[model samples]
Every structure is written in C-alpha cells, then in structure tokens.
Target: MRRMYFIFLMLCSGLALAQPRIQLSPPQAVVDSVFFTETTTVRLELDYPGVALRYTLDGSPVGSNSSVYKGPLALSQSATVSAKAFHPDFEDSPQVSIAVRSLKYNQPLSITNATPKPAPQYTGAGLSALTDRQKGALNFAATPKAWLGWETDTLRMQLNAPEAGKVNMLVFSLLDNAGAWIMPPAVVKVYDAGEQIGQFETARPEPGGPTQYHFLEVPLKPWSSDTLEVLVLARQLPDWHDGAGRPAWIFLDEILLTQKP
Candidate 1:
C-alpha cells in the first residue's frame, strides 16, 4: 500500500515534533551599589527541575508560605522583581526579571528640622575645615559654605529660602581625595536670593568602582528665599596633588532644597 502510506506519514510527523520544551534558568540577586537605606534582600534561581515556583513583587502574587526562594533572592525597595514556573501539563513559564535598590541614605544637608525661626546661615567660600572625614557625618546648617574655585578659583554659596515656590529640587553628594572624583562637565549655577534662577551641566561618568558613590539631581523654576547661592568653576589638575599638595578636597553631602507640595 505504497509502503504503508510512507510509513504512516513518518509516524505522524514524529508525534508532531514531540511537543514538550520548557527551559528556564536565570534569575539571581544581591544588588547594592548605593541607595543608602530602605531594605535589601532578593534571591532566586530556577531550572524548573521539578516545576512549581511563582513570584512577584512590585507586581504582587506569590504567597503560600511566602519565603521559599531556593537560592539567592533579596530585596529592600525601589523594585521590580518577577518570576514564573508551573508545569502540570505545561503552560506557564515566561516571566523573569530582577531589579532592586534600597539602602536609604538621604541626608540632603541637615538643617535640624527647619520650618522657620533663624536657621539659615553657613556663608560661603571654599568651606572645608571639618575633616577627620567630616566627623560623624550629617551636617546641613542650610548648607552653603561653598568653595571649589581652583584655576583662579572663586565659587560661592548662601541660600536661605524658607518659603516661596519654584526651585523644584537639588540634591548633592560628592567626595574626593580618591573617594568620589569623576564629575567633570562643569557649569552649575542656581542662585535665588541673590538673583539668577537656573543653569546646569554635568553628565558623563557612569562606570564606577573604588570609593564609589554618586547621585545628583537639579531642577528649578519656582523661587522664594531666605538666601541661596552656589557657584563652582573648577579646573586645575596638573597632578593637583593632595594629602599635602593641597587642592583636592571636595565633600558635600545630602544638600537638599525642595518646594513642591
């Protein structure tokens, strides 16, 4: 019969290509480059070896004992963690993602809780005389003791705006002496209580290691003040020595001034 109808159509096309392929094994975590503080712990791994594995956070869904995680999973906050795997007949395996952050360290220059009543005066002019690595850290007396002039140096800072809208935001963190120096693309000016309302520059240096820590954001349109001024015109490093060669000390942390209900 024509060789049994060509071997019964090649055994029904080899049982329709043996349909049954489920493979997935890639999802692990342990992330923290610096977020300061919030919470952190995420660990996950899968091959579906025995099936049954579900997860979701920042998406929601995965609760039975709610802590099964076989190998590597930790998350604290600022998230997006996902997972999927469940075979009973095969039909549910396509969702894997891991992204996390949260070490919470937002100091933005402490002013000891200010609402009003004399709390804005730190003057300016290359302010840097609290070393020992800045004592116990955390200091924001309305932050504005500025100084980064080098190469004909001449920078300033003195902002005291307790009220008045528009100034959006400004957050800072920088330390150098071989600790956090990689911010090069100058031109940053935002003075309000002295005039000028905006100016921006800095974008390049995103591959870190070694005393690493960088975070900066600027945006201003609203203005109302008690006093404010910050100017940095930097450029002077022909091996600008430090630790004795002078000129090599820039440490400003958590200096925030916000207004946006």
Candidate 2:
C-alpha cells in the first residue's frame, strides 16, 4: 500500500504539469478611422475582469512584460498599433494590430487635364477625384466609389499646383484586384514644367494573389514647379490571367504630394 500511494502521487503531479495554459481573447481596437491627415487616437478595450491590455506602436511583438495600456494613444505619424491582453490566470492573448496612415503633408494639386479619360462607368468623382482625399474600398463597385479606372496602356495627366513649393515625395493610392483584371501602374513618370524630373517602376505582381490596395511611394529629387505632368503605364496581363494578351486595367483613387519640412 505504501508503494501504491507513492505511485499515485507521482501520476497526479505529472498530470498537473501537463495541463495547458489558457489564452485570453485578443483586445478590441476602437478607432474612428485608420487614415488621418494630421493626428489620430486609438483606444483598446477588453471586458474580462483582472485582464490587462498591453500595446506597442513600433511593430514590435507584444508580451506580458510590454507596457500596460493606460488610455487612448495620440499618434501624429504613420504607425501600426498592436495590442494584446494579459492575465495571470491565463496565457497572453493573441495580438491584434491596426495600421494607420498619415497624409498630413498633402499639398493642394489641380488636375488641369487628363488624356484617355477613365471609363464612363468608373469615372469616380471626375478629374477632381485624383486630388480628392477620398479613398476607395476593396470592392470596386461600392458606392460612392472613388476609383478611376482606365483600360488603356497609358494615362497622361496635367497637374497644376496653386502654391509654389518644393515636393520630395508622391504617394499614389492604387488598386490591384486580379479578379477584376485591375492592376497597379507598372511605371510612373513625373515631369516638372515639361522637363522629366523623376521616374519609377514596379515589378510585376505575382499571379493569384489576393485583391488589395497598395500605396506606392515614389521619391524624387526635390523640385518646385507650379505646372506638372504625370504619366502612368499599365502592365500587360500575364498568360496565366484570364484576360491574357490584353492590357490590364489600372485604377487610381488619390494622389498625395508630400513636401519636406
């Protein structure tokens, strides 16, 4: 009987050590918008009692020892807010992250004219759409849609800036939806006052990738000009695509001009 009691005690201890730790649910992130002009605030909430929320803004992994959540965070630049819940009774919860973009330095740009106008069905808000701050959703057909789609190989846009300022960067909000045969611009060339100043090209996208929006940032040699011209080139659909041999459609919603301080 003594030997049996010792054996029973050993089995109980083994089972206790083998038990798995429970994980709490991830915290919920509350924010008005993910894209902001100058600043925005993000708040985290978890209803479980005794549970603490921890977060990071620098894309670092959140752990039990991370900074504890005190209140909403005020952010001025682009960042990704990642948060997780922690509790002594349970393992750390899975991390949840939200990305926020800043278009704070968007200078006012006027579209004087455009060659090869967008399709009638997807004109968006017309020429003003290119400079408008509005963004397009994943669904191209969703209303009030903000996507200006072109089925041609190239698009030439005439732009005029009312204010004289030096610009260093241009951000183009483009859509890449393979299912709809819409591809991002393959190349973008910028001309300041009829002189070619900068040009950039993008690699062909992998086939069968999920539909998503992309923000392409092109850095240029800082230059100041009131009148400008932009050329966008479309990619030809690969043989693997359903619309093979044809020029893939290109969709653009907004262009943001950023000037160095």
Candidate 3:
C-alpha cells in the first residue's frame, strides 16, 4: 500500500509540473484581410502572455529557423503565411497558415464614364484613381483621397487593360455606412464591349453595422480583352432608410484588375 501511494504521488506531481497548453490568436478576416487595395499590413496577436511567436511568408516550415515576429508584417503579393508559438517548457504550438492575396495592378488606366461626378478635393477620385494604389480603412473617410463618389443609381465605366491576357479576378472594394445612406450596389456587370463578361452581387449588412468595409470580388469568364466596360446599379433604399430620392453614393477605390497573361 505504501509503494502504491508513493507511485500515485509521483504521477500527480509530474502532472502538476507539466506546462499549460498555449493558445495563439489567428488572423481574423476584417482586421487582416480586405483592408488594403495594393498592400496589406498584418500584425500578430496571441491569447496568452510570454509566448515567442515565429512566422514565415514563403510557405516554409515555421520554427526557430523562421523569422521571429517583432512587428507588423507587410505583404504586397500573394503568399502562404505560416506561424508557430514557442515556449521553453511547453510543446510548440501547431503551425498555423493562411494564404494572403492582394491585387498587384499598377498598370496605367484610362477611364471613360457617363456623367461621372467631379472627385472632391480631399475625399474623391477620378478615372485614374483605381490604379493609383491607394487604400481605405474602416472609416468611410480614413482613406478619402483614394475614394471617388458617384451620386447616380447607375454607373458606367470603360477601362483600358494594361496587358492583354486573361483576367482571373476583379476586386470591387467598397464602403457601407447606412446611417449616412451610402450603400453598396444591387448588381454589377462587366462587359467586353457588348458581351457580358462577369457579374457581382453584394450581401446586405444586418442593421446597425456602421462604417463597415467589404471587398466584393467575382470570377470572370477568363476574359481576354484590351478594353472592358463596367456597369454598377445601386440599391434603391426603402422609405424607412434615410436618403431616399437622394441618389445613393457609390464610393470606389482601386477597381483592382488582376490578370495573368
């Protein structure tokens, strides 16, 4: 009986000496994704203290061999990012990876739209605005210089492609501040001259989300055209919503044209 009690005490002591499980925070969508038009700055966070986190951007194994995270990581192109948390006595946390992507369009763009509003000095943009590589944040006015406003319900634009190739994606980055009565469009259409190429639709936000930002991208028919025309029709607000009769505002920045030729 004495020997059995001694062995049980040893097991209990060993269990008590073992280190606790470490929990690391993963990148959340709104906070990390969709915040930029050209480049995205990602920061790492953890749920527990005293953990040393290491990360890699090149899809390599993450460990002490990887770069120790000291500050926010900036990514300009697509990468498979991996991270792991390390502690002295505890087993290393499982590797966490996320595929990060952004539009890499720096092509000079020529734009022609019907009845386009003059971009305001501080908060608006013109035809050349989309390719300017500027980005907006959570606030409707955070990156105002990058945004161009249109008052009409319908918008028509003709864009000249920089390279002749297949465009895989078209990113429509937009802002939603319903209280200010600025909302996303009901439907958007892309045309290569007269033929329809791609179409995108948006999901309405549950009421009471003020100043929300969303990236709405759609797959193209893998279009190959020198010039593309885009049409956007805003959703008509109901009587309960303010700014009726008044034209819905379409705030646009970086109409990202992602192509691989």
Q: Estimate every model's Cα lDDT from 0 to 1.
A: 0.45, 0.81, 0.67
Candidate 3's residue-wise lDDT over 83-200, tens digit each?
7887775668767655445655434455655455543643355567666656665465666667777767788877787564545667676767778777888788888768888898
lDDT of 2 by residue, 82-101 (tens): 89998888998878876666
Candidate 3 steric clashes: 0
Model 3 vs. true fold: TM: 0.59
Q: Per-residue lDDT tens digits of candidate 1, residues 1-261? A: 999999999999998878766554433433443232446566555554666666766645544333345654545554556666665665565555443434242212223221122112332322332111221112222334431212223345555455546447654445322432323224557777667777766543233222322334466766766565766543333243232222223344335554322
Ranked candidates (TM-score, high to low):
2, 3, 1
In model 3, pairs of residues that clash are: none
Q: Which ten residues in a row have the lowest lDDT in candidate 2?
A: 161-170
Q: Which ranges of candidate 3 are over 4 A from the true structure?
A: 1-40, 44-101, 104-108, 118-125, 238-240, 244-247
When 1 and 3 are scored with lDDT, the better candidate is 3
Model 2 RMSD in Å is: 6.1
